[model samples]
Target: MAPSRWDRLPGGRLLGGLLALGLLAGCGHDAVRRAPPRSASTRAWPTVAPADPASANAVLMRALGLVGTPYRYGGNTPEGGFDCSGLVNYVYRDMLDLRLPRSSRDLAAMQGPRIPEDRLATADLVFFGSAGAVSHVGIYVGEGRFVHAPSTGGTVRLDRLDGPYWRDHYSGAKRVLH
Candidate 1:
């Protein structure tokens, strides 16, 4: 007669060994982490430049100065408020005479250079999202910094491209240089 079932462990030897293998595989599933770029210059670059200056980046710098401003969905003026793309259009229009689309969707469709974070230039449009959609945009001033209107109850301010929140959501960046 066959040995009584209770005489053996609950799991068959083969099953137990497979379970151990699975556990080991689980421990090795961690994804690789990518690091941000570092600058060779000791002096950190400024986030934005003056509205008008001798530097070619003056326009981009001026755009960054609008960060921290509240997100107004539809507001379009400095005193009132601004939406994501609206603020973007306004800045380029005012600073560089460049007219941009009024909505994030439309702006995302524009053709531009897909620049890496390390090569980001002042005035370039930094996009955010998984599909490289222009869900959110800001002006890259320099030194891994950007200027944008954060949200309601806020004003324009500067932010780091590598910030916890921004880094996670960053999709891509673009530059429309003539």
Candidate 2:
């Protein structure tokens, strides 16, 4: 029998072979690099921009179009429904041609620097409190509000960031579009 195509990747087989040695090597330094977030406001993905609110507003409006759509876990389209992260993922993709992580954990890990809460722009990402960890995220709209899928009974809407629930659990914010 001939070797399969999977065997052609240079390091694929050799990578697995090194697992036992990697464990024995005690990769503690790298382990610490993956430490759990300790604060509510950790970081927001940082990037350079020329300060464009018009683009931001257009993106926010596009996101608002999907409000009142049903919430379907793991959904990523308006035809079916959307969860929190799914909504953000779709909006950024559709409006600004940007892609976002599919889950809140991956989204949260994207933090680099924080944008001021009051200065929110379109296509910015906002993190909400986790039940036990980061369980929710949304796209920020202007005026201290954000559009999100929220929970079981709620439809996506522009919510005040200072609300007791969101305020207490505001993890951080990031700008990803424009």
Candidate 3:
């Protein structure tokens, strides 16, 4: 039998290992390390739990209240701040006690009814990325707006889905509440 694909390359195993290490190293440097502290007004919004845990509206409300929270790599709490996925994870956990995958890519693959952009409702998770990879997520809040912890030096903020940046990077959306 002809050698398998792996045997066709010179030092294939070693090359693959180096590529993996390079990718992992690149990931750590993507997020900004430090940002200005949260402003006092950022603390004004109250994170009130909604009366109904399963309601999408309730989840949206909770998510909106988190606007202005700082962004931190791998952070999942308001105190330490939250990354995009962290913000989504925290809100769902708080509102419905539903534990979601920790990464944006995993959340995109989660088993929920897929929602087309036109049908997206409040609390639906909107995804964004390039090269067919899901790298960012946000919670839909209506009026074509979504809330998220954007990036280093950026805090949770509401952004329009129609905005050039979001519109261009739009991959798809998923409704997690249902």
Candidate 4:
């Protein structure tokens, strides 16, 4: 007889509970543990020149400040709230006069430096889902967390890249700023 799904797990209920709390390994499947980048500086956040709108710090701060904004599919402004891609578009356009591709898939496909997950830094655009078929994008805020307008009924918020759900779905990352 074949083993049940639960039976295949080493600790069954204990492991299930730990996964639920993001304590144990991610999803108990193909989860890869990618650590966030660290800086030599003692600052809580990574240092970058904020004077330049193209600077990573500038972009990251702008995105972080918009947390709690309502998620609006197809919406693009703070007044109207924002969707994931809209938030990215608005930030780049408003901060640097740089207009990014409108959809998450398009943004993921845009020409830029592809960054490895372990090397992700502030303001990098992190993608989720398969390559060429990415479904979500977020602004990396260092320490393995990112800010994004996740879904309908959800507000813009920060989430861990190493967390179970995201760890399993992580596709790749890109450096939007040259």
Candidate 5:
């Protein structure tokens, strides 16, 4: 049979097919492993809708602006750098005048509507941990991504929620911006 339209392209059918496959392969995986897996008996907590979209947007903007700030364990200001919860606290406080708990564990325990992953909204706090204990936290900026001060020597940066380490340590999320 004569060459088809695909063959008429610059790279031809084989190269085009390879490119398409490469793009599809970059889309990532199906089963993301969330640590401290939820049991069937786990409570189906209520999701909180963002009552103030403008405030949420402002919080997101502030968090994004702090992307390159260095990590400091007890830091809470742009000039002083920040830790995970410190980053969350600073962004919320600076943008919305909202005061949140100063540590990741305390922030996790603070009263707020629990948010299912699918229902996560901008400015929601995503938690991570293992063995049923909350450890790290980040401000969700939508699209399965968050901005956080990841570690010592690491500057605040954006990370994928479904990225290997984050996904495996993913504990839960809560909405503090209602």
Candidate 6:
């Protein structure tokens, strides 16, 4: 038979055949193996159950949409701008109809499960502080990132949780949404 179309392409016949074979081989029951669970000491961070996707997505979308809105101390609404906690408050309230404490310190002390850094899910509140006093807060938006209104002359923005200043000041996180 004449060389097939796949054979006409450089290495296509051989590569395609090999890829097909590999995929077929991987379908066998024994082809899959789960890695052994890591011991607590060896684990980098603990995991937690994910938050409700609908609520989390709504909160995240609302928070992200406000990015670049100017920061105003004690401001809460989009029209008025926002402070750190005010941004968080507006997001949760706007998206989930959930009222939260207006100040970061109060929000930190509000009732909720404290989530570790690695366990944070979308919409979880990440806190920052010094001398054991919680002073700033932001909404966790997955991928070690968060959204907040940073400071005077700044605007709502996304920042990395692992950033030097944030990492050093990270007090803890709290899950307000189930």
* Candidate 1 Cα outliers beyond 4 Å, as residue runs: 1-56, 130-133
Lowest summed lDDT window (length 10), candidate 6:
39-48
* Candidate 4 C-alpha RMSD relative to the actual structure: 14.4
Deviating ranges (above 4 Å) for candidate 2? 1-50, 130-132
lDDT by residue (tens digit), candidate 2, 83-127: 898888888788767776789878878855566765566567888
Question: What would the per-residue lDDT of candidate 6 be over residues 126-171, giving only the tens digit for each residue?
Answer: 9999999998999988777889888999999998887779888999
**Candidates sorted by lDDT, best first:** 5, 6, 3, 4, 2, 1
Q: Write the per-residue lDDT of candidate 5 for residues 60-132, one digit (tens) a residue.
A: 8999999999999888899999999999988888887888889999999999788888898888899999999
As a whole number from 0 to 100, the lDDT of residue 35 in candidate 2 is 77
In order, candidate lDDTs are 0.68, 0.74, 0.82, 0.81, 0.86, 0.86
Off by over 4 Å in 6: 1-49
Candidate 6 residue 137 Cα shift, in angstroms, is 0.2
Clashes of 3: 0
lDDT by residue for model 3 over 1-178, one digit each (tens)?
7655555689876777788889887776654445457643233222323234458777888898999899998899989999999999999999888899999999999897777777776777899999898899999876678899899998989997777788889899987764
lDDT of 1 by residue, 62-102 (tens): 56566556677787777777866777788777766778877
Q: Can you give the TM-score per candidate against the true fold?
A: 0.63, 0.65, 0.69, 0.69, 0.72, 0.73
Off by over 4 Å in 5: 1-49
Candidate 5: RMSD to truth: 9.6
* Pairs of residues at least 3 apart in sequence or in different chains that clash in candidate 5: none
**Deviation (Å) of 156 in candidate 5:** 0.4
Query: What is the lDDT, from 0 to 100, of the residue 148 in candidate 1?
Result: 74
State the TM-score for model 2. 0.65
lDDT of 1 at 110: 82
